[model samples]
Target: MSGAGNGFPVPDERQLDLERLDLERLARLRAQLVAHDCAAGLFYDPTNIRYATGTSNMQVYGLHNPCRYVFVPAEGPTVLFDFAGCAHLSAGRSAVGEVRPAVSWYHFIVGERVAEKAALWAEEIAELMARHGGGERRLAVDRLDPAGLRALEARGIAVADGQEVANQARKIKTPQEVLAVRAAVDGCETAIGRMAAALAPGITEQALWSHLHQANIELGGEWIETRLLTSGPRTNPWYQECSGRVIEAGDIVAFDTDLIGLHGYSADLSRTWVAGERPAGDAQRRLYAAAFEQVTRNIPLFRPGVSFGEIAARAQRPPERYRGLPGAALAHGIGLCNEYPLIVDPSAWEAGGVEGRVEAGMVFCVEAFAGEPGGREGVKLEQQILVTETGPELLSARLDETLL
Candidate 1:
């Protein structure tokens, strides 16, 4: 994963093969999908496709690329619908079972490649399913947009929303995946040292991020992620990108950033500080305090038999206010994705409906004051841990407080 584009250098770790993660993930996904009565599922989300077919294809470009869809028939095997000659995908350790590189899209339309390919690709998904074991097959679709939904509907395929099964299976971290996440966080923490080392008054946020970027590249940590080297009031915010703002003397700077490890696994971590005496800025102090308090509050809830809702209910703490910020829950999640199930914002973990618990061997980001969308500030907690028999195990050793 060359951090150069952000963190790891050339000869980077991004190239680290994900064969092991792929196998475990695929087996898990397959078992879950079949068990759910889904005859076949079309995965268009890049992450899902990668989980099934072992290809980043468009997921790597991050914001760009319209995404490549991979179809895995429950009765049959998995295949990818993309551009020319993707048969090589079958050659990898995490190989796809089949490849359908659509030719019509090549001469079909310009600027609308993904749309065109998707249109034609939807037909292929239907045809492939039919050929394998057609008619009322109880199909499922992952990440379907309006257009894609119409196309699948027209095909007469009974497509059900497949993300639910996917989310449940994906939330738990396999041991291999956990190890990879730990490695990624290690890279993030390493990059943090580099970012802090170059910090000082008069240094621009862009300049410090550049320093952090360079170190990540040199260390083979691909991508700087969110270079939030903010000062003072900005620290009380979200992933505010690097501005030309200068870190004046006595001001604070927080570099809430990360590096994706060699395995394409991401590490979302943050570090807050100042250019001068590292004054106990209310925002930083409150976040750290909330994080510590919440993590301590939630760690016990992570056992094998506890429900996520139970943990959420019990996670309340001392209602301290910082810069008028009220006290909040601590401990967020860290995994293949930034899925914080403990704080079920979008993913439904209501009382009695959700029985999800901390299974042993599951990896988590215990950055206190964290979890889900619609969360209060001071949630940029950044610790990573693994669930164990004794309890949640810290993977990234808690470092010395980097600031005074």
Candidate 2:
């Protein structure tokens, strides 16, 4: 399957080093802000903050506290409001033009100072906006504290949903972004390969799950998104997290690697396995076959000019026996996290999926699950794909031959 038989012109074969805040990416994001008619963009979401300024401080801590933020004006310099006295964290590392200390105790339970902190945070934001000519223009914020919102309203700065603007900006992958995601996938594949080798009977699900976490941390990745490793009957309904249950022989084990890897890019991949050295049972084999078919069959449906609805219509859905399983969408876009364009079956297209055409440089994860109602175990498979001008290009590594 080469040449124009797939679709449009094939993209160039170029490689790039993963620089999280390359100049081009920053410029493109700022351009998107301007295009959205935003005077300035303020981000409290950790991912959005990093995307805007290429700086992250106490990210997990900041998720609950709105003290860390990034501000990007439509035509001026970028700024990072650091948490507490951590302004030095982003001084020379990020592309941001300015770094300021803006501390807030929004998550603290020490009396009512949280609201006072929020007001202070809002006042600092107002001052920043005024310095950047955003006083009379609208400010878009991805997440805001209630008190901060009130203060913004008092200051007469119209606040819009910055998450929408950020999502649209991030929907398309720049060359460097694609490269970073590929690097993240490479790291995840390495970790998964190690896990594959370590899989065996009598190993606790927690032990196996720890291998992935350890490997990811050693490889400089951020925390994983979920604890989705389980064995045997626990694998049936799909939302089970890893536990202390010892994996028995002939049991089915499944895991989803919703990992945030190198450079803050996400690599979402899933694999299922049999615990014993012996081959998978007939029913397990059938389930695996169905899941594999679902992933491989629907990949080509994603390409430039293909509408999400059409892809949903043509996608291979879960088998009838597994119709009641927990899966909701057949495929979805992936970037810093599971981003956009959840492609569903035609029956669910209007309800769950968005209406838009796939374009070049969009990355997606085609997901599939198969398990009977009240069954013992389930099979899950996922593939990371890049929608190129020509067709869908697989970014994830192939499953181990033994698993097939």
Considering every candidate listed, which one attains the maximal lDDT? 2
Candidate 2 deviation (Cα RMSD): 5.6
lDDT of 2: 0.80
Candidate 2 lDDT over 1-404, as tens digits, reads 11233232222224654254456567767787788787888888988877777676777777776767788888788888777678776766546888887656565643578777767777877887888855555898998868778878887788988988888888889888888888788778777867877888989999999888887786778889899999999998988889999999999999999998877889999999899777788889888888888888898888899998888777887678888766647788889888976777666666666888899999999988899989988988899999899999999877555555
Q: TM-score of each candidate?
A: 0.79, 0.92
Q: Model 2: which ten-residue window has the lowest total lDDT?
A: 1-10
- Badly placed stretches (over 4 Å) of model 1 are 1-18, 60-64, 85-90, 102-119, 133-136, 212-227, 237-239, 277-287, 316-318, 323-332, 340-355, 368-380, 402-404
lDDT of 1 at 226: 57
Model 2 CA lDDT for position 250: 93
Candidate 2: clashing pairs of residues: none
